[model samples]
Target chain A: MVRYKAIIAYDGTNFNGFQRQSTGRTVQEEVEKTITKMANQRVEIHGSGRTDAGVHALGQVIHFDFPYERPLEKMRFGLDTQTPDDVAVKSVEIVADDFHSRYLVKEKIYEFRVDIGKPRSPFRRFYASYFPYAVDVAKIERALPDFLGTHDFTSFCATGSSVEDKTRTIYEANVTVNEAGDELVFTFRGDGFLYKMIRIMVGTLLKIGNDRMPADSIPAIIAGKDRNLAGPTAHPEGLYLKEVRY
Target chain B: MVRYKAIIAYDGTNFNGFQRQSTGRTVQEEVEKTITKMANQRVEIHGSGRTDAGVHALGQVIHFDFPYERPLEKMRFGLDTQTPDDVAVKSVEIVADDFHSRYLVKEKIYEFRVDIGKPRSPFRRFYASYFPYAVDVAKIERALPDFLGTHDFTSFCATGSSVEDKTRTIYEANVTVNEAGDELVFTFRGDGFLYKMIRIMVGTLLKIGNDRMPADSIPAIIAGKDRNLAGPTAHPEGLYLKEVRY
Candidate 1:
């Protein structure tokens, strides 16, 4: 068997999520269906990770095996044409026979978007979370550094999560204001993430940024190790799986 | 009766057009429905002009008469709450009883957008017209001056138009490239425009920019006084009724 790796991007507006289920449209199902049609064989593709419903992806990686080999460009173009318009195989390459997308991940990055300082607009209704209240960027910037280290992120993960491991190393976290100053972007890069970790973290940071929470509230939230201690989970539509590095 | 004037804006993605239609949804119907409900009386509103289906507007003017007077702010807010998310009333005020939206208009400006130099995607599906090929901005600029002076403009008007007076004066016509240069905006300001006039003019300019027509082709097309001489009408989504000046 020959292993093939591909980078994918999707809008996620109409998708149930990145994983396949018995029903509903999904990014995984769309790509897998196209690959099956192109290769004339049922192929189960493994993604680096699963993004929640309404979460977008710009560089979600996946791997699958096939019985035969062909020109890489031909396979990529063939899959692209067959897949729906919302999902695309950005790049594809032949890899080692044993390569696995999920097991080999070294790091991941996610971005959360906040649309603020404008009248609620219909243009960004599906892509951004509109926050009408004023937020202090300096306060948010000052609070993000507290997230930059290995910690037990049980407070950030959603309740009833199945994973036993609650610890993750956050390599970098920062808040960037767009030039127009109407958008606030929270970007997180880490060794790995817990379920709904970034959204919870962003929500907590937004609370601090909006002066609802003190800037120094992070240590107590982390020390509590309780999901209820953190702020609410940000909306899924504002979250994007930005990158996965191997 | 008290005359009221409003500046309206709409996405126009779902509407049939601005004029009243028997079946499909239209801007006129949406506003009239809301106003009728607000006033509890049958009312007739006149718009500055009609916009084709799928067109957008940033500043469309309209006028109507209501028997009673209320705070302008209250009326504007009431209309906005009743309209769909894609449309809004930017401002409203009381006007002279004799004022008419269409009859008193002095000039109008329209802008058309083209998204070029990127793989076509669903994100801009309703907002812009995508053109993949390269264009010569200088060639288009050279051709625009020919549209500035008063002319019959028969070539730029759609066939089957019933207007007998085809002469119109174009005060300004220019092509602007955005800072990214990936977007080319054609802005036209004229005393008045005939049916499909701006769309056909932009189409002809685009053809010239793409090397399909010579930069000097404008004069002959105008002198021919025939709609068949001009390029095909551009897509409706890119057109916007930017402003109606009094």
Candidate 2:
């Protein structure tokens, strides 16, 4: 068998999530179904990680083993044509047998988009989180650097996350505004992230930007290791898995 | 009674069309329902024009009568809150008793978006038409001026349009690329448009851009007055009713 690695992009609006379940449509189920049909056999695929419902992805990675060899371009074309419109197989390549989509990940980059425009745009309702209230972008920018380096992110993680070790290394963190100056994009590059950690961080940063919370509270929040010390989790719609680096 | 004129925007992915009908959900139905609920009485609204299914709107004008006068801001807020998430009430104002949304329209601007990026973006699938083949934007730009000025646009009109007068004034026609250079937006401003006229014109222009048709064939097509001579109508998803002016 030959192992293949592929990068995929998906609009998660209509999906339950990236993981497969008995009910509800999912990205994994759709991709597997398409690939299995194309291969004329049952095939399972492995993903780098799971993204929650309503969260989009631009470079989600996955790997699968095929029974026989085929041209990479032909395989890519076949997968692209067979997959659902909401899911796109961007590129495919042969990979080493030892390559693991999940365990071998080195870094990850995520993006969260916020629409700061008034009278929220209908076209962006599904793709961006609307924040009509006043926000200080400069203050948010000043606070972004605090998220870099290693920290025990228990306060930022979702309450139900069962992982014991909450420490993760954030290599880079920054915020940028689009050319129109109506939207804010927060980008985070990290060794790993806890459940809903990025969303909670964004939520806290937005609160700081709005002056509801102190701008310099990240250190205390991380040291406290209590979820209640952090702000509420942001909406899922604005979050995107931008890249999974190996 | 007080007359109110409102500018509305909607994501038409889930809507049947702009006009109210007995069957599927429509923009008019949603807006009327929200107003009727707030007024505690049935309210009928007149729109500037109708847009087909899957066609979005950024500045659709509508006028309706209410039993009493309320603060314009309050009415706008109520409509914004009560309407579905995919619909937004941009602004509301009190208009003259004789003012009519449809009859007083002096101009209209429509936009058609084309996705020229390879491997179509999943996020833009519902908003832009994907053309993976080669297209020359310069050719499209060169062909745009031919659509300007007054002309009998019979060839650009759809086959089923019953309007006898096929003449219309085109004040401006241009094609612009976005900052990302992955999208081509075709903007057309005219006195009025017939059914599917903008879409047909965009379809023809895209054909010219792709070298499938002669770049200077627009004049002959307009003089022909035959729908068969024009290119196929573009997809409805890429078309937007950008503005209705008075």
Candidate 3:
């Protein structure tokens, strides 16, 4: 048996996210089917993490074991030949048998794009969240320092999550406005995230950015330990899993 | 009646084309409906040019006459309120009665993007054309200078065109590759174009760029006045009307 690691990039617009499901198409199923066809055997893939539907990825990491022995170049070529156009294996390499994508991951980064324009462009509808309202950039910038450290993040997590621990360390959190002054990008890097935590943090920050909430209220929201204390969850379309660090 | 000129933009993925058709929705009908609803009277819109199905526009020029009078700001707001999210009237201004979008246009610019990769990206599938082979950019650049002046370009035009004059001045033609080396953008600015002219030009350029045709053969192809001399028309999804100048 040979263990292989691959870096993937995909547009999750039509996918049911990364996990396999019987009812719909998924990124994992698509790659697995292609691999099975090439290897003439069933293959199970282990991904670094799961992404919600309509969320895109640039450098998602995954590992799989193939029955046939092959060089990294052959494996890369075979996967490219079998995989569909939407998903591409950017790179492949041989890894130790003990290597695991999930357990070995050190950190992950996600970016959310918001199109804050009165008239949204059709070209951007699938890639950005359109909010036709005013937002104060200074206010949003002032609130970023509050989310940099370790926190329970219970209030920011979605309700009914199965995860037991909500505490996560955020390495960085920043909000930037594009030069066009019509778009904003919110980026976060962290060790781990609870269900829908990033989206909720974005919403809460948007409210504060628009002056609907005070920057000082971030601590109170985090301390509330209730999902209702945070703002609404942003759309999945605007979120992208940008990178996974080892 | 007051004449109003407006700048429009749309993602053409959802519409049949710029012109109205009985089989499916068109951008023209959508804009006309919105104008009628806002003015409380039917209005006729004349676009500077027509784009085929699956093509997009960033700054398309259009003209319409309305009996009702309103401030430019108010009319723009009202039309935006009633128009679909995909199609937007970016700006509206009262123009001289004789200002015709099509006849008064001095130049039009179109952009075509091609992605050169084995595995296509799903997010960019709707926005770019994918070519799996490597292209010789030097050959394409060498062939482009031959097409920069006024000439009979019937050979570069697709068949079934209704226009009688095949002569038009090409103000500029440039091909710049993205830094990633996986994408190329072809930009053309000209007095006007015959039906599918830009598409055919792109196809022929790709042939030269890919070394399928010799760079020196471009002038001969244009002078031949035969569609067979040119390459196949490219896909419409990769084409965009970048702007219209009047």
In order of listing, the candidates' clash counts read: 0, 0, 0
On a 0 to 100 scale, what is the lDDT of residue B173 in model 2?
96
- Superposed by TM-score, candidate 2 places the C-alpha of residue A242 at a distance from the truth, in angstroms, of 0.8
- Deviation of model 1 at A115, angstroms: 3.0
Better of 2 and 3 by TM-score: 2
Residue range A1-246, candidate 2, lDDT tens digits: 899999999999899999998888999999999888877899899999999999999999999999899998899888987898888888999999999999999999999999997678888887888888899998898889999999999999998888999999999999999888889999999999999999999999999999998889899999999999988899999999999999
Task: Give the per-residue lDDT digits (tens) of candidate 1, residues A1-246.
Answer: 689998887888899999998888998888888788766899889999999888888788999997799798788777766788777666789999778899999999999988884344545556777786889989998889999899999999999999998989999999888887878888899999999999899889988988999999998999999998999898898888889999
Question: Model 2, range B138-171, lDDT digits (tens) per residue?
Answer: 8888889998999899899988888999899999
Model 2: per-residue Cα lDDT at residue B224: 92
What shift in Å separates residue A78 of candidate 1 from its native position after superposition? 4.0
Q: In model 1, what is chain B's TM-score?
A: 0.98
* Candidate 3, residue A70: lDDT: 90
**Would you list the rank order by lDDT, best first?**
2, 1, 3
Q: Estimate each model's TM-score.
A: 0.86, 0.97, 0.92
* Number of the predicted model whose TM-score against the real structure is largest: 2
- lDDT for position B117 in model 2: 75
Docking level of model 2 = medium
lDDT of 1 by residue, B100-149 (tens): 89999999999999877344444555767777677999999999999998
User: Of the pair 1 and 2, which is ahead by DockQ?
Assistant: 2
Interface RMSD of each: 2.8, 1.1, 2.4
lDDT at A168, model 1: 93
Candidates' lDDT values, in order? 0.87, 0.93, 0.87
